[model samples]
Target chain A: MFTDCSSSTTSRLIHLYNRNGVFLPRPSVSQFSLRTTASTWRCTLSIRSSSSPSAIVIDGKAEAKKIRDDIKIEVSRMKESIGVVPAEDSSEEEVLKYVSGFNDDPSVHGVLVQLPLPSHMDEQNILNAVSIEKDVDGFHPLNIGRLAMRGREPLFVPCTPKGCIELLHRYNIEFKGKRAVVIGRSNIVGMPAALLLQKEDATVSIIHSRTMNPEELTRQADILISAVGKPNMVRGSWIKPGAVLIDVGIKPVEDPSAAGGERLVGDICYVEASKIASAITPVPGGVGPMTIAMLISNTLTSAKRIHNFQ
Target chain B: MFTDCSSSTTSRLIHLYNRNGVFLPRPSVSQFSLRTTASTWRCTLSIRSSSSPSAIVIDGKAEAKKIRDDIKIEVSRMKESIGVVPAEDSSEEEVLKYVSGFNDDPSVHGVLVQLPLPSHMDEQNILNAVSIEKDVDGFHPLNIGRLAMRGREPLFVPCTPKGCIELLHRYNIEFKGKRAVVIGRSNIVGMPAALLLQKEDATVSIIHSRTMNPEELTRQADILISAVGKPNMVRGSWIKPGAVLIDVGIKPVEDPSAAGGERLVGDICYVEASKIASAITPVPGGVGPMTIAMLISNTLTSAKRIHNFQ
Candidate 1:
């Protein structure tokens, strides 16, 4: 699901137990310890290919990388124009640094932290700790609440959901007065995605796993989206002919023949769905890039507001 | 729709203006005319009745009033025991009086401001002004954002959505691994409702007006909940035979021959849906009351936390 990267330094581990009247565990390599060396370690998890025929690829991975590149460029521009810079560190210290740095900076606008962060971190606590003014991800409770309630607009929208709407807009898909079915109920994707689609004047319905007969329900959708992580769960027969399908699931299943012993897949069976659906996104390229692109967009928006930039 | 409570009390108008400066035209409405006496005003809207009916009443209005009465009683008991009162000031004078009267009293743990304030008001700024600790409605952006993100729970939840789940729980509706369809995408009822349904381990999908064929999609729901405000928009044929229907729409349609010249209705066509569906919630008395009751529950929970009485 993710690439693991490790870089090592020559600095020795500091065991500061009982320092400043605080008792803490000593820094020692144990069974649970992460292996490290002076250089760097990078491993790309490959997806397994199914025996099934070829399917349409929704390339989210490539899109996410492109967005990251874009952000890197904009970040450089900010540093060039002013002394201000977005956090280079992805730690709590980096969060604090940006929080205090953006206090009065006229050059920085929005701030964002990538989602699906490491399991040890609490997303809300970290989001709350970030300056609300720069919370470009809109994952903060305040932003979400504002998005949910009327009369308040979110400073930032969750990236995946934003990407979903953006795709519809890009593809010139008509949503007004049309019946839409959104599969999955994740807050970051399904919930906000439905809200955005509804805002666009679509009569929206949310269908989840609890739905008794999903295939029957999905067959009615003119526009269908699946964000749940179950690979190949939505079949071609599930979609109505000429229906627009957006698959948000990205997973790696085992494949012994592939280069990496695995291959990527989407929530919908791209092969079968593409034949029946009018428009479908490819796995790996479709929605993957939009999240980070939206992140950059949100960050720039936040920075613009903070700096009062035209 | 809302009633016109316009009055001739200049001072009172001024008071409202001062209290909600964000939405009011002027910081002080002392310069405008106001009504000195309160008058009865009612909603004016109508919906077509079903030819033959079968839906059971969900009864939101009765439930809300009952919950309010319970709150009033509890408020009295709290005041008698701890010499503190909940904030109820809608005017400058009352605000001053309450602030002075409750100086530093920590006994009042939760403060909830009932929603749907007069049309001449700013809901967002007013709700924002509530103390974070006493924001029982969870309408605040901070609270909403937390609710949207994974692993972050809001201290409070919006009342109606909570009530919907409460009914499901009370009735022992099996939600786990079931497919649920939630119609509408409103902030209060639709968006949060989908999230709550998903949190209960059901696969969820959201549909709205843009949906091309809602009837076809709806027939697949094991559980169907409609929060769309349209009167009797959902028909009997649109539902699955055994699907559970939770209608959140409460509209008062024009009924010239009826008492008060109006009749209450729901999003679903009651009679037809009830006959076709296994169970359905009626308008007026259904989800409406649960909102207020949940508000009370949130308040009590907040109070217990504040007083360490739980």
Candidate 2:
């Protein structure tokens, strides 16, 4: 998880804080605190995979790589067609350049950034900085605020949640009047996922850590999407038979039994839940692949709009 | 509702989006096919109160007045004690000044803006502009974001929801492990209120317009908070007898039989809900008073903090 991006920026601040007691205010520092303190170090990140083990891998990493390659090809094509350029510098700069270019190009339909960016970056600020026209991920506060309000539609949705809904759409899962429970409320995944589910006309309820008796509520869900990063936090007892389960959690678990003494798992106990639920997504290959696929879709849409392709 | 504040020298941006075609984008004109024919016209401003015999008066006008008076007294005292010049302009101005002042003054603690601001103004922009420190309403995005995350507390709770919870707290209602359903996910009321209930260890569910089978979920609520602006949206049949109800809506309903053509009403059918509910707040006298009282409390806290008072 410590990508090359993490070392260059926040390491400077950490070095300063260690050497000198005076900690200067950097927006990056607060984000770093949120990342290091909240997700990785404080809790167990992984668990065992499937006990039954018929599950297919989602392969988010491979999917993301495929999407990035497609985007690079499209960017070059746009240049060939109209002399427009996609930035080769920072992802933020590249996103801004495409969004800013939207004023002149009505054809450019989408713009998106890959998620799990370096923790030091302000996600919301960077997302909002994307011009509204090219906001393929639709993570901007304006888009989020619009999505939250009645009678408004976000131009684009965050990739992971969008992928979840697309899965339902592709599988022809009926959402109308269905009781749905979203077990997270992050701006990136759970919140938008719930909104999309509601847009599909499902009766949605959000249960977070503060929610008491989450299992009871989950047991009632005909459709459940769990994005709480906690590994195997959801038990088999929580599944409502015939319910469609989408597990978005991907945790790295340490186990001597597995390769390299570690393995990936999801929020739900796959063995038990799969037995009861009608359909369920596996940790590494299910929701993960869809996320990257949607990212590619969003980027292609953006490029099409930029090139004015009908 | 707008009022002249007791403060001075508060700079504010009064945004005007003319409904009379001042800034309708060119594309919208093309869609309407009235680009040349469109002409500006001054629209009549009216506060069209509702018309319902069973209306419950919310009394925002009285509540806001009382709050302002209380703030006036505190501002007078601060002047006497610290010689800090308190600004007086308008309701919007007062909120801005206090928020801006609170940002600089280490002593200031809490700040709030009275709700039902003039319809001409942009509510979200104004609310978002309030410094998070003094956001007593807790409507600011940053504060709301923090509240949504686990292990976080807002600087101040939204007064309306806080008042609703205070009623539950005072009445010895047990929400812990109890299922609570909040209708409406507005940033100011519903969303934050659900978060607050969850923080109290209640199993909380939020239902908005997009929710399907809202009535079915309402039946599951041991505690219900309805802030859906629709008057009498939550019927008695929807409520579970003995369930505690907090009606946060206060809409004016016009009645030719009454002295004025209009009177206040809540989102719940008060007569029906009161009969079924173990306890219920009267629209005019219950949550209304508590909200204003909390605002005063927040303002006093701000002043004390500015003065470094323990």
Error of 1 at A165 (Å): 3.2
Interface RMSD of 2: 4.1
Off by over 4 Å in 1: A1-98, A103-110, A113-135, A149-151, A203-212, B1-110, B114-135, B177-183, B201-209, B222-224, B228-230, B254-257
**Interface Cα RMSD in Å, per prediction:** 3.6, 4.1
Candidate 2, position B125, lDDT: 64
lDDT of 2 by residue, A80-134 (tens): 8877553334565555554566645665545675564556555676666666545
lDDT of 2: 0.62
Per-residue lDDT of A41 in model 1: 15
What's the distance in Å from true for residue A234, model 2? 3.6
Write one digit per residue (lDDT tens) for candidate 1, span A91-138: 766665566676456565556665555565566766666666666677
Who wins the DockQ comparison? Answer: 1
TM-score of 1: 0.66
lDDT (Cα atoms) of all candidates against the true structure: 0.63, 0.62
